[model samples]
Target chain A: MNRLLFALPVLVLLIIGGFFYRGLDLDPSAVPSAMIDRPVPDFALPALHPGKKGLSTADFGGQPKMLNVFASWCGPCRVEHPIIMRLAARADVEVLALSYKDDPQASRAWLAELGDPYRQIGVDRDGRVAIDWGVYGVPETYLVDAGGRIRYRHVGPLTAAVVAEEILPRWQALQQANQ
Target chain B: MPAAKLHAKLAVVVLIFVIGVSGGSPALAVRPDERLSDPALEARARNLSQELRCLVCQNQSIDDSDADLARDLRLVLRERLQAGDDDRAALAYIAARYGDYVLLSPPIKASTLILWTGPGVILLLGFGGIIWVRRRRPVTALPPLSAAEQARIKSLTAADQGPQ
Candidate 1:
């Protein structure tokens, strides 16, 4: 009993240290989106391409799709652009794009250079639409389910690893549940 | 001068500076263009912005941050107020999208009760620990001095007294 009493403080210290150690590995910058499981906030943006139809909440029904929020000026978006292209090519999920706070001309030129993989592009010129979407930064992605509810949101760039790991598992799970 | 003295001087300078600047007009980040036409509406907007976190900066409130998203949030708050939404409705609109994390001081709720009470709980635990340790000391105290040990002590004191 005395030995146990002597070890009690050490045990408490170890537990507290364990919590702090776990905290060190956490990314403080990744603010989890409050919009998850909620319906895509209502928004309609102009077409990034002159003739193509723009994007909106109405565009999200009948299938699960990925909405990539990116800007021409954002560096990480370019890094993730190829992965988006690959995803679009697989034809498993409809990958859409929101051009956040970007100039249309610049966005068009970027798409021409990078090879546009988006099914439809929405232009959020002043970034007001992004506010409703709770976008704190560029290059966020939201995976919306068939029922127009946002299932998951990734705050930073989407990578091939992320697509394979995070996106695929959730996508598969969502598909099974739907069926 | 020694390092400790130098640090003391610097501390005094900082203290004086803080005291000197304590009562000045606060520097608001709200740009003139973002302000509503009506003062009452603008004041309400300002109050709401103070409660909303600048998600980009995370630590600074939207009213105090100069980040682009902070500016956009300020505009959204003003728009809501101009449209005649009450303070509760205005805050709820922003909170709906950004989550409770966006609120600088989130209201106490089922999810937030722990956050609000954690410090106090730790304080109570600390007091309990102190009391337990204090009380346990008596139970685990050194055994009473033996009779032989006491006699040896008495002889030692007698010898010392004689020498003195």
Candidate 2:
């Protein structure tokens, strides 16, 4: 009986440790994109500015685009916004923005304070669109081809290195392929 | 009872209760500065942060911490909010920087099956042990008390009654 008591705690510790260790091997940040090489999901939302329309998946059908998911409330969004604005000037590619779980007024104000680089902004109020995009967090950017298929994903703030090294080349290749 | 005495007794009782409640939460090491003024936002931050483990602190969350890394995490959350990011986005940003280990509530996956199911598995094993113990033990009814044992019991009862 006394031996069993000692063994019981060890057994419990082993079980808990096993679970903890199991989690260490898998990267939860890398969920498989549902839009992988497939046409993007479709939806049009109220535009950020008056008298202008926002995006649906069809808008991206003929051009390679970078879809950046952001919110006015997220901090890293500020860190990554500048790079996105810089990418916007590259006439070869279009930048589509998704405003997630944010008030429209706040989003518009945020863009005004920073700079609006998005060719079109889609509002995802409930984050349903974010989920559909297989997004786990904010400031995630996806690269999509003209076919609306997702080509690449960046999990955090877009750095200069990532843009210069990876995104630009991929965008060029896709642009050339369409021509 | 005198009013002064009654007040003193109440004070003692209250002190004991305070100690009891505070002592139960020894693992709650969160500092005052780590908290927010808004109850709802603070609760949301706490709930979300607790789901994320601190990378430097290992298995502990910012909710259970007083370290510099925890302070940085708190700052990260506030920045996300000020930038117009929602709770999920802020958490994801941190997760991206530190990896999923930064999450206290791990995502559900084939690899995490043990984490999700461990408690029930342990309870089942415990119950199975109890059943095994019961089955292995012999059922022995107490033999009826012998006549001598009854006489000794009667004397003991009589001896006790003599004092009355």
Candidate 3:
């Protein structure tokens, strides 16, 4: 009994140590999105490009697509530009972009310089629309199913590995479900 | 100095340290334009902002964060207030969009019971363990000293007292 009493503190310490050890491997910055499996919030904004129709929540219902929140000033958005371009090229899914809290002229110049990859670009000058979408920061991507429900959310820059492993598989699943 | 006076001085120093550490630094990040004209509504906005977490900063309340997202949240709160939504309604609108994680004080529910009560439960268990250990400890009674040993001890005490 006394021996067990002596061992209790050590056991508790080991349990706490195990939890901390597991926490070390997890990404502290990755906050779980609350928008998953919910309908995309209502928003109507002007187009970033001249002489084009503005994007809205109504635009999403007809197909499975991806909505990317990005800004001209956001470095991580620049990092994921190529991947977004590649995703745009795919026929299975449509890619839409929201220029979050960015100057429309700057956003246009950015797209022109980087190569335009978005099917429709919405200008969120004041970031009010982005707030409705529960955007913490720019460079977040949401996968919307054909029913206009948010299926998955990816925070931070999209890497080639994430595209192949996480995004592609999820997109495929959503596509199959639609079929 | 006397011991009581020294203790009072020490307490005063500690009080000063605490006041210094927790003084009204007003780390408010609310921009001038964000403030409502009506003092009563502005006060409500400030209180509401303090309860909402700044998603970008993660650790800071929107009232205390300079992050763009935090600023956006503050603006939204004010907009909601201006639109005639009450405090609970305004908060609910944000919470529906951002989830419960955005609230500084989470509501009490089955899901959060452990988070709320874990510390208190741990403290009770600690006190209980201390009491249990003390109760279980056997106090051994000392054997009576021999007359010879008592005499020797008395002699040693006398010699030590003489030197003192």
Candidate 4:
């Protein structure tokens, strides 16, 4: 019993040390989104492009799609632009871009310069729509299955490795499940 | 006497310096336009902003953070207040959209039990350790010195006294 009592403190210390060691490997900035597996929030905002109808929650449930929150002012959005462009080129997936807290004119110019890859683009000028989506920062991407439920959320600038390793496999799984 | 008076003067100076620094006006991050005309509603909005975390900043309340998202959250809170939602309703609305992480003080729930109880448990363990140590049996007192040992000690003292 005495031996057990002495071992208890050591065991607790080891457990705490293990937890801290695990925490060291985690990215502190990456907050897990509460919206995963939940339906996208209701929103209808003005379109970024002229003469086109705006994007809405109604556009989401009918197919597997990607909702990318981005801004012209956000530097990481520029870094992830090529990966989004590549995703947009795929015939199977529909990429919807939400311009978050950016000027419409600047977003238009940015899209023109970067080569527009989005199927539909919405301008969230006041960032109200982003708040509804629980977006803390720009350059966040959400993968919405055919049922409009969010399957995955990627919180930072997407690199080629993240695209190939994390996103594509899950997207493929979502696609297969839909079919 | 002079040293004591100098110490008193130094203490007074330190106290004044501390009070001067602490009593200065706090820098508020709330923008002028976000303020409501109604003082009561504005007060409520400010209180709510203090309770909400600025998601962009590490350990900063929305009321104190200058981040754009913090400003947006403050505006949203004000809008909710203007719309006649009660304080709880406004907070719930924000919490629903932003998750429980947005609240500066998380609500007590099943998942948070560890966080709430960890310090108390550690404190109890500390008290338990002290009590156990205090209650432990001390080593038996050493047996009284034998007569031979006493005689050796007396002879050593006598020799030392003689040399002296």
Candidate 5:
């Protein structure tokens, strides 16, 4: 009984510590990027447009670019798809999309439903292309400058406010700086 | 009970108290440096923040993390809250921009039915295991000791009492 009394607290602590250790181990959160202002990674993926060639790193050069990562399974991708289409209509900037973790047919169907505004859509079915692009989730948009340097990144759905206040101004500035 | 026993109990209590206090307090110092003003907005932000996942940290809520991206997400959340977005709107806004991966607790959609119900299914299996084990383990009966066994037990007890 005396030994049990002395040992009870240690036993309780082991249980508590087990839980705390589990929580500590599960510290799921994004790592803040160390890659800002750095050159974007090279990528080559099959084009969504039939009979057309895929996208490459050279596409990012000579033009200010917006790379939107999205998938059919993502609901937010539907909401942001129209805004991306609007952004793509501008000749001043190139809009490229990386279709992540999705079937090519599904992506085509989604684009068909939402209307593809992407000048070039690259399929990254296994997400390796997204990893190389430093993508954490779908619907992330990164603005790369004319020199292929990443200018800005928005992690979540792009809306009018985010577009006007953040993406457009930064893109315009990068484009003007190049000229 | 007795004074020595009380003293012994007090010592054990202090030891356990010290250990418990030290264990849980380490995480409190890791607050993100971001400023969140507007008490009403902050309250709403806090409540809504936990619903959103930090993409880099897949399992953790933006509110619970000190990660830089988590801080940025918190700022985004606050921006939406201040701009008159309700909880669902704010979540949907972020989701629309970032994807469903940004939600800490995923929505009740067909794709997420298994994820939402898996825990209950696992619990039921655990309870079923307990019931099966109880049924499998028979009501154990102690064997009857023979006369020789009783005599040996008596002899052992007498030996413990020494020479008498």
Candidate 6:
């Protein structure tokens, strides 16, 4: 009993130390989405452009869609634009976008300057729709299946490697599952 | 020292104590435009916002964050309150979207079992170890108290009967 007491504190330290040590390597910025496998939240926002139809959840079905949460104000969004444009040109997926809490004119100008990649753009001017979609930051992307369920989510700028490694595999899975 | 000088020194100590106790308030970012017209509702809104995490600044609550998303969340929360949703309902509505990470106090659940019970478990282990050690100790380990020592200890512990 005396020997056990001597070792008890060390044991406790080891357990706590283990948790902290494991935590040290985890990406703190990545807050895993709770919306995985859940159906997309219902929302409809005004079009970013004059005549373009605004995006809605109803448009989520019939294709494996890539929903990119972008903003003109966000720097990383610009960094990922070329990659998103590449994804947009791909035949396998329909790329959609949400302009999160950005000025319509600025968003429009930014898209025009960069070359628009999204098939449909929704102007989430107040960001209320973004809250519904669980968007905490700009440049997040969600992959929605044909049945409109959110299959996977990637926070931060979608890199080419991320698209090729993480997204492509999931997109393929969704395609096989839907068919 | 002069009486006035002594009083001034005492005043400075008291001022420092007050400031120390206050601990500098949380930086409030709730704009004037976001405040509800109804004071009671506004108070509730303020209280509720403090419990919601600002995802941008994960450490700061939405009430204390200056982020644009935080401001938008505050507006949406107020809108929900105006629409007759209870505090829990309003919070749940947001949590449904953002998950439990947006909540300052994580909800007790299967996944968060360690988070909720770890401190209690540690405390219990500490207390249990103390009791176990106490029980395991033989009475011979402690020397028998002398009559004089026992009487002195008893008297010393008695509040009113203690030495004047």
TM-score against truth, every candidate: 0.85, 0.47, 0.89, 0.87, 0.46, 0.85
Best by DockQ: 1
Give the DockQ-based CAPRI class for model 4. Answer: medium
After superposing candidate 6, which stretches have Cα over 4 Å from the reference? Answer: A1-17, B1-5, B24-27, B137-164
Per-residue lDDT for A131-160 in model 3, tens only? 888888879999999999999999889999
Chain A TM-score, cand. 1 = 0.95
On DockQ, the stronger of 4 and 6 is 6
Q: On a 0 to 100 scale, what is the lDDT of residue A96 in model 6?
A: 90
Which segments of candidate 1 are over 4 A away from where they belong? B1-27, B136-164
lDDT of 6 by residue, B51-164 (tens): 999988889999989998889899989999999999999998888888899999999999999999999998998899778777987557668899999998887789666568
Look at candidate 5 and give me any clashing residue pairs. A28-B57, A29-B56, A29-B57, A30-B56, A30-B57, A156-B97, A156-B98, A157-B96, A157-B97, A157-B98
Off by over 4 Å in 5: A1-31, B1-164
Give the DockQ (2 decimals) of all models. 0.70, 0.05, 0.62, 0.57, 0.06, 0.60
Per-candidate Cα lDDT values, in order, are 0.89, 0.77, 0.90, 0.89, 0.78, 0.90
In TM-score terms, which candidate is top? 3
Q: What is the lDDT of candidate 3?
A: 0.90
Fnat of each prediction, in sequence = 0.81, 0.00, 0.62, 0.46, 0.12, 0.73
Interface RMSD for model 1 amounts to 0.7
Lowest lDDT 10-residue stretch of candidate 1 chain A: A170-179
lDDT of 2 by residue, A1-179 (tens): 86987798799899989989999997754544445675666566667677776767777767788889999998999998999999997777689889987898999999999999988898887665565565656788988887778787887788899899988888898888878
Candidates 3 and 6 compared: the better one by TM-score is 3
Distance from true location, Cα of A69 in model 1, Å: 0.6
Summarize candidate 2's per-residue lDDT along B70-159 as a digit string, tens digits.
655665676566577788898887765455656777777898999999899979998998898788886889999999999999999999
- lDDT (10s digit) by residue, model 6, range A62-133: 878889999999999999999988988888778899999899999999999999988899999888888888
**CA displacement after TM-score superposition, residue A173 of candidate 3 (Å):** 1.0
Query: Interface RMSD (Å), each candidate?
Result: 0.7, 9.9, 1.1, 1.2, 10.4, 1.0
